[model samples]
Target: MSEHHEHRHPHGHEEHTQDVRAHRGHGPGRRFARWRHRLRHAVTPHTHDSSDKVDGALESSARGMRALWVSLAVLGVTAAAQAGIVVLSGSVALLGDTVHNAADALTAVPLGVAFVLGRRAASRRFTYGYGRAEDLAGIVIVLTIAASAVFAGWTAVNRLLDPRDMDHVGVVAAAAVVGFLGNEWVARYRIRVGRRIGSAALVADGLHARTDGFTSLAVLLSAAGAAIGWRYADPIVGLLITAAILLVLRDAAGEVFRRVMDAVDPALLGRAEDALRRVRGVREVGELRMRWIGHRLRAEVALVVDADLTVRQAHDIAVDAEHALLHAVPKLTAALVHADPAPAADGPDPHLALAHHMTA
Candidate 1:
């Protein structure tokens, strides 16, 4: 990726850096963009387009990758700043928050890998390509969130059992504010982009960041309380932060579990039905099935057609329905349309006996 980016600018080195940085974002952002370019180069294992059908899905993955990279940089800087405060102030609460920020930064690693893997072409052994890896990445993120909650709770309990002195109250307070501002900014940016791209995992990560911002506020309160000569406030605030983390954990776990079980929005099904009905020859839509493969949707639709229509005619109708569905449904990669003959009052049910969904 770095090599590719470098080749885009063959002019004078100084002017090239300034142009690329301006194109990316902030004027002085060239250094950071260059850093991200190098980081992108390190993680992207292989590059291949799955198919023209998945181009939209691939674009979503690309947006997700960019979000993860930017968030990682923000959180890393936030955690490092807090760590310096923790060392000088000897504040247990600030230390816990710093640890969590670090963990949140690392969670981006798996998601970044998943996005790269999703771009690979489908293989004989894995006909769906590597998109499911994003779901796996979601699982890793949920587990990471859970582990952070547990660690934070344990640390708070230990601190409560043996209270310790805290120094540099003003500095601790300043660091807490910095942490909160950084996380809140990241949370809003990630959630906004995630919704636009239809990525549940990225949205969950955004919620996670929002919760972390609240925890940082709790640390700020601890700093204030300690300055007022309240020794127990540090442990109490730490416990509150732990509770906040647990709340975030519950929501994140639910979303990850839903994706793992292949749950999808009912509204998406309605759109699929609407699309199929638009086809001229479809008599009655039936037994439609849909699932999310990562952020992408795939569907199998069954519908009734005129009993007098020949087999070729039914196939053509199915093809037209498939095309309609692909256009109507958001992020739909493939639609398997199975046409059935109109109901017959006589004899056995041949509809169930015949093989359906023949793809070229």
Candidate 2:
């Protein structure tokens, strides 16, 4: 067993050193172009592993916190503005949107707590640290969305049974616009950062915000129908908003469920296997597995090497394979590489006894 725990900083340093050497012979124009390229990658989300300027996990947590705080503030203000309109217009649609916005804003609290907990150092009792807190926060968010939907549906049904004329239709429309603008901005911010850091929780929150925005637009439509003397328009749109919430709830729930189940993208497994197979002296790559602990990744891989090689040689090959993986797989912080001897063609299978014992 040749285990290696790698972080982004060392690889970043190596890349920087190489960049400096490469730039020495190149013109300033080339250097500038390379700088722009790195900047683009830094700002945008992608699958390739690249050198990061800071510690990947910590920096990602920090970014997640920042996103939560900003989104919370924006949604808080938007909901407050809508709340006043709801009181004046007595529009069930506006009321439902406002309530949902408030709930969405409150979701930031749990996610912020999770991000903080994730930064704690690993302890003896919990060797993997508290990264799973983010997934828990995601569950909380999903439940919150569901609760909002239920409340909205109940209120809308009550209003539908007993229709009431709404006031301040124009004002409600303006408030709806405000809600749309605020939520759309928050959605873009949270989703971009979430994808960059690989945080499913944050991305779920972003999707929630996006649906809220569209529901807000539905409020505008409700106001228009109310102006045209349609008695049921307000409650009707409220029900529609509730249905939209349920749809987003499904998506967010699915994402959080996958994270909780330790599911990862199949492409990442392929990338890891390819990286391992490309390593020198590796005859075969076997039993490669990857899992997400929060937004970061860890891997375990088995390698087959020549049976005649010395233990030291085998160890070196494993180390090389691990290094290759660190560079090839994005967000991979650690890998455990186990080397096995290639079995002789006519001899008894070396792993058969161990495998049988394990099964037994």
Candidate 3:
């Protein structure tokens, strides 16, 4: 086989300059670095400029968010009523639902704002854009869920240790039913918003609401049990709800934390790499890396090609490969392809020669 030579084009310098500037502006290539780290950790193969679709999706999300606010308000009022009714009836379970309502109200604020922010254009500072706001908001909601769970658990345990006598069971029972219905409506609205926006945060909020709704049902059942002569059932149900909430808190908090830490789903990376490999002239893919930055998938892939190809040819191949990946991965916001000539299977390492050349 004849050995071929690689030559750099005059415009190569210009392209390198632009790539450097873009990387510098985007925060020290942290996103790219993370992408590389995840790819190195897992090697696998598996798994749109539809702006009109994005716009349509966002519009639907906005409408859902608006409905979410109204539903939350209804839930809050219902919670307040439940609190009064429970206190009058001496029902601790209803009191716990009040705390749940308060958490739901607080999380709704961030979720609504995140939905709007995710659709906004990129600023000079955030070149890749604000799509990650929804992810951050989801993180906030998860943290709140954990905190609320812990507090509720502690309170439930205390109440269980020293049970209180019931007084106005019917009033508290009525309030619990109202709260359950209201939360269910809000939860469904949030779930719809999340599906429309592809927002993990909104989905988390919806799931949180579902948990609360379930909790309310349990409280209602306990109140009914109390009225039917099972005086201890109310506190027992509250304790069980506390335990279930803790488990839910763990899952929500863990997922949100991973997303915030820029954890790329391995399957997504494999799919991207496989797509890039399909491009012609791409001899092999070295370090294929990817990460989620807000709503955009930022990828930095190292492509191996024939060492004999001209610089322009290599550059063109890289560009084509990148475009292919972007088109294939709807979530891909941006990509950086580093073209590296394939090294001989058994030959002198290029690094030593390059280092010597640099010193000379």
Candidate 4:
């Protein structure tokens, strides 16, 4: 089978650089292209350009980064407020919750770094790009959650054995409300951006913050228990928060582990196939592969076209296939479309595809 290939990525669209000269032009169009070309490369940290596929990837990553920084600011302020309450109340439950909030605020650091790294251009050694850094950040987030769980659990156990009087109960309750509001706001923003950007790691981070907000509410319960003369209530709530943290750990760990293993949503593959079939000259969809490289998605596909098509014609088909996938698949930053020659009309169909196959 004769194969012609086309590719695309981060800031621009490329039909295929099958012919090097096809990419170079003269006059005003060339000047405009040059500016956009420079902008795409300059904006993206990674060199995984489909020649210059500056579309949604650049905008999406930028949005993810903005969300991280904003969330960091909001959470930091919330943690500071809670810290003041912890100092005044001497409530260990509030202290544990405060610590978790601080850690949640700090998690934005790793996530932000991941976003920055993910923007770097792709190189020969890392053809898929540095998008995997976000997944690594997700690992850090999961570990932080686990650490918070252990710390909270230990404090709860210690207090269970030796209960202490909690002061400034009213102040602690008010602080808990502040923590909840702040964290919930950050959580919503993070999750919204993460989902829009197709970043599993960011989504996990948001969930972590949401969990912290719930723990903050638990601090409120601890204060109520103290008011009611239930000496064990504060520590019990702490222990419960620990259990909740563990549950969140399970979820975040599963998400990160799956991404580390390069697992993607099944629906994505279906969309890729549908997109390939929609192309005018794609006879049969052979093999389609997709994976998340950080928050951006990259795809590779094998497409069958009529055997008699010229190399140039096959290249055009591949170009169309790539363009279709880019438009149809969500969050897809790059794609490699390989056009394979189908069996001649008289020969037996080896791939045995359905009757919907296209003809030359």
Model 3 alpha-carbon drift over 4 Å, by segment = 1-96, 167-171, 188-196, 344-360
* Tens-digit per-residue lDDT, 118-203, candidate 3: 67767899875676787888888887777767766676677668776665777877877887887788778877766554566776
What's each prediction's TM-score? 0.80, 0.83, 0.71, 0.81
TM-score of 3: 0.71
Model 1 score (lDDT) = 0.74
Candidate that beats the other on TM-score, 2 or 4, i.e. the better one: 2
Per-residue CA lDDT of model 4 for 299-345, tens digit only, reads 88988888887887788777667766765776776688877778776
Clashing pairs in 3: 89-168, 132-294
- Model 3 scores worst on lDDT over the 10 consecutive residues at 8-17
Residues 1-360 of candidate 1: C-alpha lDDT, one tens digit per residue: 000000000111111122222223445574676576456435643222344345556678889999988988999899999999888878766787898787777777887898899888789998978878878988888787777777767877887898877788899899999999999999898888877766677777887887778778887888888888987887788789889888888887888788889888899889778767766677888888888777777788787887777776677677666655655676666667777777778845654544565445
lDDT of every predicted structure (CA atoms): 0.74, 0.78, 0.67, 0.78
- Segments in model 1 whose C-alpha atoms lie over 4 Å from true places: 1-54, 87-92, 352-360
